[model samples]
Target: MKEYHVTVRRSAPEGGEGYLQEYTVPFPDDEIVSVLNVLEYIYRELDPTLAFFDHAACRQAACGKCMVKVDGAVKLACKEPAHETMLLEPYSTRVVRDLLCES
Candidate 1:
């Protein structure tokens, strides 16, 4: 099994402070995984408090609700590939918590 590093920007709800946290997750190197998948893994297996937004339309990037910053580039989380090392951050709008941006 191969492991990857992900640095996530986290923020508290209601105009609280923000910070960056890092995590190590295992993934199949030969297979392609989306950034949302990695976030799900972290939320499910590592930290339940991790917050993010996703909807049914996220499968095709039609909703635009799962938008986040990957290495300083804004993209739909479901459409961005989870790389060996990624820097994940919420949009510059209003961060509700973790990777969630206020709609």
Candidate 2:
């Protein structure tokens, strides 16, 4: 497995200013994986303090729960493949907590 960096922004659960936190991920294969999976991976293996309530498998890009700013571009977390060095931030709205913004 290869290591990857996943950086999530810091914020509050309700709303607040955001910052960044980086995590290391191990990708066993080059195959693409959703950002939600990456987040889960980080939560499980890296940090648990990071807060987020994600509902993946809706597969519907409309839900917006998986919405996040990746490298400064707004994209659905479940829709984008986890990059090697990903920088995650809240979506353009209220801040929820590192990587999770108000939808």
**Candidates' RMSD to native:** 1.8, 2.7
Return the lDDT, model 1, position 52.
Answer: 90
Give the alpha carbon lDDT tens digit for every residue of 1-103 in model 2.
Answer: 8777887778745555456677888877865777777888888877888776577557557776777877889888778877888888777666545666565
Tens-digit lDDT track of model 1 for 1-103: 7787999988755566777899999987777888888888999999999999868545678887888899999988889888789999987767777888788
**Alpha carbon lDDT of each predicted model:** 0.85, 0.74
Work out the TM-score per prediction.
0.88, 0.80
Worst 10 residues of 2 by lDDT: 12-21
Q: What stretches of model 2 exceed 4 Å from their correct place?
A: 12-18, 56-62
